[model samples]
Target: MATLHHSSFCPHSRFVRLIMAEMGMEPHLVEERPWERREEFLMMNPAGTTPVLVEEGGLAVPGASIIAEYLDETRGLGLSGLRLLPESPAARVEVRRLLDWFLQKFDQEVTGYLVTEKIHKRFMTSQHGGGPPDMNAIRAARSNVRYHLKYIGYLISRRNWLAGSQLTYADLAAAAHLSCVDYLGDVPWDEDEMARNWYARVKSRPSFRSLLTDRVAGMAPADHYADLDF
Candidate 1:
């Protein structure tokens, strides 16, 4: 069985989880804090990031995008339908573009804010290298949330999924980052019905169930957090 060492609040980890779910592959899970700097964990991933995958034969795989591609290639599930990556140049470009948007743009603008404010202190209360989170930064992120939501609304309004017609890794990436924000009650679901509807579908998936169960000390998630219908 493949083992995953990850934190529930991480969007990148969640992205890989969504991919395994889309492929109908489930792996055993283990929770670990990245900051502990454990010898084994650090050896497995010198970058010291979560979402490291231990393959069946025991090779530590780092990074969500890399792990997803590994799963796709090893499992023989080419990205055509739900997997999203395809042999065709057009399909590959389409999926790649969306993946970049979510992993880079969404993570930098949206997840960075909420994770630092709500989730980071839990794992990083001791590792205050960056000093306390800038409330101003969080405030800025909160303000930027509206723009992200509107952008998503536009995408969902035009395309069925964030990338291409089918539910691709891009949707999972967006949903993963959004989930972290949602956990902090920062997401304004009421901003767009279309966006809300899209999230509902992504939230209802079984892979997302684990993420919904996450809780940070003294930081209780909002009431609508686990509610699929809400």
Candidate 2:
């Protein structure tokens, strides 16, 4: 079995975890704190990011995107009808585009700010920027998330999933980030019923069970965070 270096609240980590679960690969999960910049972790990934995959041969694959591609190449593509990536070039581009939108753009604008301010800071020490949560950043993230939710609603209104007719890496990526924000009780699910419904479908999947049960030590999830019908 492979080992996964991850963090419960890190959207990128959560994204990779979801991918593995979907691919029917259960890895040994080791939660990590990227902010600590541990020497060993740095050796594995110079950037000290989470969601690094260490295979049986000691090969460490770093970053969510790289890990996703690596997993698909090594195993996921063999899943046939269950593959998270599409086979056609145009369809694959759509999946990749939405994947980037959620993991990069939505992250920078929403999930990153919310997690850094609410979750990451709590676990950090004073010297490592640990302190009271930044209300300003938190508030900004809350406001920005509504736009992304609206975008999700717009997309889902037209298609069965984020990228197209089938579930793809894009759906998992978006859900990973939304799940983190939802844990903080920040996602305004009521504002976009279509988005909420889309999320409900993803959240109800067997691959999402582990994530729904995730706990962050001192922090509790929102009331509806684990609700399948919500």
The candidate that wins on lDDT is 2
Candidate 2 lDDT, 173-217, residue by residue in tens: 999999999998999999999999999999999999999998988
Cα lDDT computed for each candidate against the true fold: 0.81, 0.93
Question: On residues 1-230, what C-alpha lDDT tens digit does candidate 1 reach at each position?
Answer: 88988878888988888777777778898887776777899999999988899988999999988886787678736545455566668877877787887787777887877786667765565544334667887888888888888888898999988766777777888898898898888998888889999999999988788788878878799889999999
Clashing pairs in 2: none
Which runs of model 1 end up more than 4 angstroms from their true locations? 76-81, 127-132
RMSD of each: 2.1, 0.8
TM-score of each: 0.91, 0.98
Q: What lDDT does model 2 reach? A: 0.93
lDDT, residue 60, candidate 2: 99
Candidate 2 regions with alpha-carbon error over 4 angstroms: none
Candidate 1, residue 178: CA error in Å? 0.5
State the TM-score for model 2.
0.98
Worst-scoring 10-residue span by lDDT in model 2:
68-77
